[model samples]
Target chain A: MEKAIEVKDLRKSFKSAAVLKGVDFEVKRGEIFALLGSNGAGKTTIVKILATLLKPDGGTATVNGFDVAAHSENVRQSISLTGQFAAVDEILTGRENLIMIAKLRHLKNPRQVAADLLKRFGLVDAADRRASTYSGGMRRRLDIAMSLIGKPQLIFLDEPTTGLDPEARIEVWNVVKELANSGTTVFLTTQYLEEAEQLADQIAILHEGRIIVSGTLEELKKLFPPAKVEYVEKQPSLEELFLALIGKKEEK
Target chain B: METTKKHFLSDIGVMLGRSMRHITRSMDTIITVCITPIAMMLLFVYVLGGAIQAGTDNYVNYLLPGILLMAIASGIAYTAFRLFMDMQSGIFERFHSMPIARSAVLWGHVLTSLVSNAISVIVIILVALIMGFRSSAGIVSWLAVAGILALVTLALTWIAVIPGLTAKSIDGASAFSYPLIFLPFISSAFVPTDSMPTVVRAFAENQPVTSIVDAIRALLSNQPVGSEIWIALAWCLGILIVAYLLAMLVYKRKAL
Candidate 1:
């Protein structure tokens, strides 16, 4: 099968400042491909181009077998985008937000689709409440649920867990994992190394508008210095510590 | 192409429904928009009515047109603010990336402004009636006045969209309306343009608001609406077309 996404010498600029300078990358179908980058690294620029929200100055990109520039409508039909901030309508109830997206996608039964997603995402209890009252985790889950309404072949998640709590981050991670398991390709951008390490089947580091390194976790690890044979007490990560604290407090 | 056009109307309907819900839930916006204009009407009619020589028996009758215009001017500020919020919250990007008719997103806001402003105009007119304002105009004249108000709303709402798409700050987004809200004061809305100094009179007579207010005033009192109606329509349609073209250009360039 053809690649889910292919970019060749993609270039873009704002006024005189060059962003995404001749970048090249490819993503296989049904895999989690993480574009790792820090702030102002043109990660969003790349995603916007692929999603057909922005026009590129040079090069070509094909998303889901259609040129992003020439056949944007086809590419749009094949993909959904979850932006950096949770894009829920604060005034609408959680169910309404999903139904709104479902209707926009021309779904047959918008209310039923919203109900099913609400139940699946554990948001059924909060479905009637305005999204403004939702916690950060819940809102992000709702945003992801909205994106999944049309069941696009591909999804672009930009900084999906930037400000999320550890539990919420894990929740988003599980959702992404579930998406890939269902054979939907995911293209995600993030500044977190651990997020890329935790969820990505393929990781590509974007630096200075180009991909500096691209490989699997194992292949990329080989480029580092060999690990020394030493024994030390293993420390739990902050995520583990926080979860443990919360578990103890709840039990008490 | 056929399918895209088919989806456009339905897409606008969906977007419009979403925005109308925002308006209905936030009743404060409509109330806030109506409050200032109504207060101004009361102030002008009760306190300043005897002094100003507007050459009309009931000051409320003369002031209603201007008050309605002011209410619409303020009402559309919410349109800019809502669009700005969407841009900041990333919802704008999500919508843009979807496979829907893109311009429908904006038409939704524009049409919502028309409806919300219409509601404000109707409320203000009801308040004017309670204050003893009356009109000899029949149904056709009423519709003509409604048509003018709708045109004004469309023209101003398109102007609002420009700032909505391009403003860097929330304050900047809504601030454009302050001048618009105050524009009626300098026109023939409050008093006859002949009462002003020569330069001010020249401006009052020439500005779009003057023609609009005069046309509305004539239509309300069942006076012969001569050239004022044409001039008013010209101003509104001119502004509408220019503002719409400019707004679409900004939207295309901003790529939001």
Candidate 2:
């Protein structure tokens, strides 16, 4: 079978400045492939190309058998994108926002689909509430839920968990994993190294618009072996120790 | 084509609801659009009406149609501004990723502008009626006025969407609309084109504002409209088609 996503020598630039320089990568079907990069490393630019939002200055990409440039509408039909922020409309209710995307996608039974997604995202209780009123986690959930309206084969998540508590972030991780397990190819770009380690079946480190490294977790770990895994080795973690010392002194 | 049409109609209905919700939520914007034109009509009719040399009819009657068009022109900008906001917010990018129709987004915004402009026009007309502005035309004539206003709004809305998609700043998005707001002043909307210089008369008569206002004015007055109505519809339809094509072109080039 052909790769779910294929890119070769993809170069993107904003006028004089190049953002993505001859980047080559491919994502296997049903695999969670994470593109790790720092800010301005062209992570989002690559995601945009794959999602059919931005055209590369040079090189070409294909998503789910459709060329990103020549067959954009076809590529668009098979992929969904969730941007860095939870870009839901503030004035629209959670359900309205979902339904808007559903209707735009020409979904059959939009209301039912919206309800299912809402329930699936655990947002049914807040479905009627304006998305603005939602907590950060709820909004992000709704954002991801909106992307599923098309039943897309590939999902480009550009920083899916930028501003979430640890617990909420883990929930998103589970969701991404679940999507990959269910045969959806998840192409993710994230700043969090741990997130890549946790979720990615395959990984590529994009630095300065080039893929400096590409491998699995074990493969990546081999390059910088024994990079100081620091631990406190504390006497009862200090906080607990201090608390017990103070309590004993008080009792004495 | 059939699927596209189905998607378009569905998008229009859904977008019309969303746009109406936006207006209803902020209602102050619609009220401002509705009341500003009528207020100007009131001020012009009562304060400046006596000095104006529009025609033999009540000055209110002569100026009412212009104010109606102005109301629509002003109201339609908000639609563009709203579209701009959505574009900036990454909503269009989100829409593009879905499997639905591509043109639905633009149509949604265009139809919303038409609906809200309709409300603003009705409000202005109600105020005009209260202030002794009369129209003797029947339903067909009224429908003609509606058609003219809808086409005008559609054209202006498309024009507005261009900046909304391309502008770097919020104020920049709506800034382009200022020239549109000022257009009616130079045309026959406010004064008789015959009174202007020869050059200005040619411009004012040929530009869309004059023809549209004149067609609407003639329709409301129950006068034989002659070819002016055709010219007006042609201008409105022509501008609508051109602006729409240009906007979609520019919008396609724009990055989210």
Candidate 3:
């Protein structure tokens, strides 16, 4: 498979403090590749470099066959980034936000693209509401929808579900999985182990500005001693109960 | 290259649209812009105008030009405020990742500042007119007033961009404008520089605001503009070029 992203000995520093120290990784095309890291592990720095938002102090990175530093404009044209923050313009309505991105991308029909994305993201009902009034889940959905404006072949999602409740997190996960299913490569950073296990086709754990280990889920699982599996009657998880109660309350 | 130019223009338009939307949504900025300068005008014309002799019989007309400058100075603080807000949010990073022309982002804020400041000036002018501010100058002189105000706004807005990018707090971002607001007082805006002490008079007579104020005052009264217009233009252009370069440099460093 073609590689979507390639990083070699990536190094970045903020003043005297080095953030990424000789980190290296690769993400394949059309796969969900998760980078697991703790806070200050330099996941954001890596994402910023690959997205051409920041230049690496040392080493090299390429995205979609374009050198991030040398052909940054070309790389930028092929990728979209959903930053840690929502990054949506709060004063604008959801529809206006999407239209703004589409227009910025120089699409021929910004209005139609915005309308279609709003419907696809199940945000049509809230499309005219200002983004500042949106629920956290709605804002995240709008953010992802905005990123897909130009139908970029590669996407960088930096901590896509950091503060979300389970239902909202799953909603974002579904959107991410759909992107990969449609053959768009996804590079995401996360702090949740289950998130990596559930969605990623491959995972790399980043520790202290370096990828400690990387492999497919099953391949990494083999490194640990196996325990006997047992089946029991499953109960509704607390998350599920919480979501159900919230849904009912809103309905009433 | 042709398509790139086209893309740059379109991207600026789109970003300008976003900034304009924000301006319309926030009513507080509009109120603040109108109230501050008009209040200063009313206070000086009623209370202080009687005591301070500024060579003109109608203090409102003499004070109107400088108050317009003050209004613009105050209005541009909002530009820094908005730019600081955009910087704090990750939108700057998102824009950095986009393929659009890099300068378009700054231009959007700059253009929005020009538009909003122009509106604030117009509102202040209308209030001045209501309070007996009049001028005998023809179409060309009126155009000159607009032109000079536009240049002043352009110059100061670029200066505002510097703090907006580098400031750690909102107060820090906006504090730069206080000096700008105070500049008119030290110059010939309220009282003539001749009435001041020697050192104070020297500074007031040589500063940028005095020339701008004198030029506008001359144009309003149909007096010969003479060299004050040239000096005012020189000051505005010099500050504009320097501030533009410094702001862009700071912006590039912060983006990293």
**What's chain A's TM-score in each predicted model?**
0.97, 0.88, 0.93
lDDT of 2 by residue, B231-254 (tens): 988987888889889988987677
Where's the lowest-lDDT run of ten residues in candidate 2 chain A? A234-243
Give the higher-DockQ candidate: 1 or 2.
1
TM-score of each: 0.98, 0.90, 0.97
Please state the error at residue A229 of candidate 3 in Å: 5.2
Candidate 3 lDDT tens digits, B1-256: 2444678978998889999999989978977988988999999999888999888899998888889889999999999999999988888888888888778999999999999988888888888889999899999999999999999999999999999998999999999999999999999998888899999999999999999999999999999999999999999999999999999999887775
Cα-based lDDT at residue B250, candidate 3 = 91
Docking class of 2: acceptable
Predicted chain B of candidate 1, TM-score versus the true chain B: 0.98
**Clashing residue pairs in candidate 2, if any?**
none
Quote model 3's TM-score. Answer: 0.97
Candidate 3 interface CA RMSD, Å: 1.4
RMSD of each: 1.3, 4.6, 1.8
Model 2: per-residue lDDT, tens digit, A1-252? Answer: 569998999999998899988999889999999999988888988988888778888898988877888887678778899988677887899999888878777878889999999888899899999888988888888988988887888888999998886657877998898898888999999999989999999999999879999989999888886778689665566646766686699899
Clashing pairs for model 1 are none
Give the CAPRI rating of model 3.
Answer: medium
- CA shift of A16, model 3, Å: 2.2
Q: Which residue window of length 10 is worst by lDDT in model 1 chain A? A: A69-78
